[model samples]
Target: MPTIWLFAIVLVTGLAGFALARGRAVASAGGDTRVMHSRPLYHGLNGLLTAMLPALGLLVAWLILQPVLLDRAVVGAIPPEVLEDGAARSLVMADVRRVADGLDAAIAAGVATPEGLAALTAEDDVRGLLGQAGVALGSDVSPYVLEAARDMRATAATLRVVMWVAVLAVLAIGLGVALKRSHADYRARNFVERGVLVLLVAAASIAVLTTVGIVASMLFETVNFFSQYPASSFFFSTNWDPSFSGRGGGSELGIVPLLWGTLYISFIALLVAVPVGLLAAIYLSEFASKRMRSVAKPVIEVLAGIPTIVYGLFALITVGPLLRDAIASPLGLGNSASSVMTAGLVMGIMLIPFVSSLSDDIINAVPQAMRDGSFGLGATHAETIRQVILPAALPGIVGAVLLAASRAIGETMIVVLGAGAAAKLSLNPFEAMTTVTVKIVSQLTGDTDFASPETLVAFALGLTLFVITLGLNVLALYIVRTYREQYE
Candidate 1:
């Protein structure tokens, strides 16, 4: 059976078990209002958990493991010479999966029964037959590979049958146990709560686990990159250049220029976003009428809903040109339309709502009594806001700003379109420059050789970006924790 079908069966069984267990528990208490150890709802939930968790867990494991096991078995059956001399292993495995799927298609289309399909030789127009059944191979299938596909299909079919049996058996056993444990003194509520707590903890840990996994994968590939390229050249050199596969190997691959561009653009973005967003937030929270707040706040936040690509286009077609003509050119700076200022301004515009909306909510969340206390001390409105309200909201405002800074730092589309892909260490914001992210994309683009430092360098760049963002978050956390006030 298909996985979805198995899920439906499990769900239906669990629901049925719930009803049965709820009825059983009620009957055991003689339908008394207070005699049972737990409510009918808790008893039913206990039954549902019992029938679902073990069966679903097993099904999940089976789904993950079966493909891996089958692939290993089929790969072991293939001759090593084919992978060594013929083609890449990934291509060969892909062919194996495609052919297996073709055989199943042939069976479905009545080109051959499963028995006849197994008995057929690879020499007997296998490709044409599979084609007739709507699976086209790039080339002729070898006898061993054809046989391996057949074995894979056969083994997968058997495993599906086994998974079906095992999942159902577990479900049945669980329901039976729940039925047996449905007495008044069974403590069904406690069992149910414990199971719920375990599930909640698992859900909560997923983010941490995912972060660790991401860091580990990048670190491994980064280690691979560093093995081929010197760490000193990558970190200390000011250049950012990578040689093509045919151009021979003396690529500079320096990170300094890219890091400078990244920080420079981010600094400009923060400069634009922070004061504007914070002031807008303050106005909305402190000065706006209720009607204006409802309308204007959403209007301001609409910038957040606008796509970054759209902002990139705006930077390219509008903002970039405007800045070059109005400011850069008139000031005797470089007249390039695509410049650090162009991207930074556009990115800052994109990030405004991120800061403004968050800061607005945080400022509004400050206790009303704080403002009243300031007023009672004979402080003016502006003075009270500066001294009392802002300080009280400082931690949350810091968090909001940090969020905006992170967004600015990671921006890609605006940087790409507004700031031309010129990696350079320049003091002029009017000069075009590219960031680490843009280079990461460029290095990994097209048919890249994984063994080459050029491709592996993307992972290193990514790891560096991750570390930078992590440090920012840590710094923000330290600032917030250190300065946060305790309110009664």
Candidate 2:
């Protein structure tokens, strides 16, 4: 059965269990709710929780493990001669999967029967047969792959059958247990509540685990990179050059240039965004009437809805050229359209909504009594806003600014399209520069060897960027806590 069908079956079964257990509990209590220790709804929920969570969990686990186990088996059965040229087993496994999909498609197209596919050899025109099924193959199917595809299909069919039976059995057993406990005196409410609490805790733990997993994965790759490339050179040397020369050794994998570009562009972006966005927010929150606020706020926030790539294109096609022609060329700065200034200006425009929306909300959240108290103290509207309201909302504003800073630092598309990919240490804003995020993309983009330092360095760059953003977030949190404590 399809996975979706299995999911539907489990859900329907849980609902059925809920109805049955609720009816049984009510009947046991002679249809008198006061006589039962727990309500009929709680009894129903207990049955549903028991049957649904375990069966869904089991099905998810089965789906995750099935492919891994099958891939290992298929790879193991592949002949030694298939790997004589030392092609990656992963690539071969990909081919095997594609062949299996092709076989399925061919069967569906009625071009080949299952029995005929099983009897086919490497000498057969397997690619042509697959093409008739609309699957284009780069090369002819090998004997081992053909056979392994068949074996994989057979094993997968059996596993699916077994999985279906096991999941249904688990659901039935859980429902049976819930029904046994569905009497007049049992604490079904407590059991259901506890199960829900466990589920909530599991959901929270999964988030933390996902963060740990991301950091660990990048840390492992960063360690591999440092093992091959000297950490000192990567950290201190102010040069960025990655050699894609298949032989791969003589590249000066320095990050200082990239880091400088990232910081420089972010600094320029913040310089543009902070004042404009914050002032815009202040005006919208404090000065604008309800009618104007509703119309203008959404119009300004429409910038946020525009995709980053569209901003990148705006930078590429409009902002960069205009800056180059109007300022850079006239001032005898670099003549290139793709420059740090161009990317920063465009990125700042993109980040405007992140700051304005958040700051506006935070400012609006300040107590009305604070404003009234300032007025009672014989202060004018401007003075009250400047001294009372702004100070009260400062922490959240700082947080919003830092959040925008984090976003600016992580921007890739604007930097890529607006700031050309010339990694160098230059003071001129008119010169083309690249950020760490852009360099990470460049390094990992092509078909390259992963074992090489050049490729692994992308992970190191990624980890560095992650650490920087995390520190910014921590700082934002600290600012919010400290200021809020002092004032509140």
For residues 1-488, could you state the per-residue lDDT of candidate 1 as single tens digits?
46899999999989988998899999988888398888899999988999888999999999989989788778766878766732256567777899999999998999989888878887889899899999988889988778889889988988999999999999999999988898777799999999999999999999999999999999999997888789999999999878875422888999999999999999999999999999999999999999999999999989999988999999999999999999999999988999999999999888889889999999999999999989999999999889988888988899998888888878888999999999999999999999999998898897666667888899999999999998988998897777784543
Tens digit of per-residue lDDT, candidate 2, span 1-488: 57799999999989988998898899999999999999999999988998888999999999999998788667666977665533256567778899989999999999999889978888999999999999999888878888888888888888899999999999999889888888888899999899989999999999899999999999999997887788999999987778877535689988999999999999999998999999999899999999999998999899989988999999999999999999999999978999999999999988899899999999999999999999999999899889989889989899889989989998999999999888999899999999999988888885666767888899999999999998888888887888778676
Q: What is the Cα-based lDDT of residue 442 in candidate 1?
A: 91
User: Residue 186: error of model 1 in Å?
Assistant: 2.3
Best by TM-score: 2
RMSD list, candidates in order: 3.7, 3.1
TM-score of each: 0.86, 0.89
Evaluate candidate 2 by giving its C-alpha RMSD to the native, one decimal: 3.1
What lDDT does model 2 reach?
A: 0.89
When summed lDDT is taken over every stretch of 10 residues in candidate 1, the lowest stretch is 82-91
TM-score of 2: 0.89
